[model samples]
Target: MQITASTVSLTVDDVAASQRFFTTHLGYAEQAAAEGFASLARDDVAMDIVLLARGTEVLPADQRDQHACGLILAFTTTGIEHEEKRLRAEGVEITMPLREEPWGERLFQVTDPNGVIVQFVEWATPPAAENA
Candidate 1:
């Protein structure tokens, strides 16, 4: 089967609170919902996160322990400066400020309400120029 898109599923403490934070601050549109779960998407690419109440059935047993997620979700953009400024103005805690990496990518990192780290990046060096 061909995979058109992918999503990172995250277990959250509060469904409504997480949904609101993503909708209000991160600008994600609600795509679907079930009894104790909701899905949000950006630019039509759906995320696999399912938020459940702290004491709900789907909630993990060890709620106090922090979940270790393997990959850091990154979103590419053409306007890194504009996004960084907007996020800072909204009181979003920026873990990593805008900076150019050794690989020549301008990027920043922000943590969501549920502690999910999201990265926004822009390529500074074009592949064509690098190859020349």
Candidate 2:
């Protein structure tokens, strides 16, 4: 099947807080919103987010009060260092400082107002591939 689009739904204590964070810092625009929910999207394909307020009735009973945890909403892009610096200059807290793995993956992470972990990564060509 062909997929049309994609989105990540996060349950948070404050939907508006997360909404503002995404729009202000992450280049996402508000696509739709309601009393306890918001849908945000970037112009790029497949970058959509939906935030639901904790305890909102729209969620399943077992998941209604759950907050986003144990996950990092990551974006892989170019100029990882510049993005990190730009975010820092904008007063965005850098939870994980930029670092590169031996395998050539450079990444860093930031936390949103509602404690959502967002990470950015850039993968370098492997040494073997570079020599090929």
What do the candidate models score in CA lDDT, each in turn? 0.74, 0.93
Best TM-score goes to which candidate? 2
User: What TM-score quantifies how close candidate 2 is to the native fold?
Assistant: 0.94
lDDT of 2 by residue, 1-132 (tens): 997889999999999999999999999999999999999999986469999999999899999878899999999888998999999999999999999999889999999999999999888774578789
Off by over 4 Å in 2: 126-132
TM-score between model 1 and native: 0.77
Collision count of model 1: 0
lDDT of 2: 0.93
Residue pairs that clash (backbone atoms under 3 angstroms), model 2 = none
> Each model's TM-score, in the order given?
0.77, 0.94
Task: Give candidate 1's error at residue 48 in angstroms.
Answer: 5.7
RMSD of candidate 1 to the true fold? Answer: 3.2
Taking the tens digit of each residue's C-alpha lDDT, what string does model 1 give over 47-76? 545555445555566753435255576887
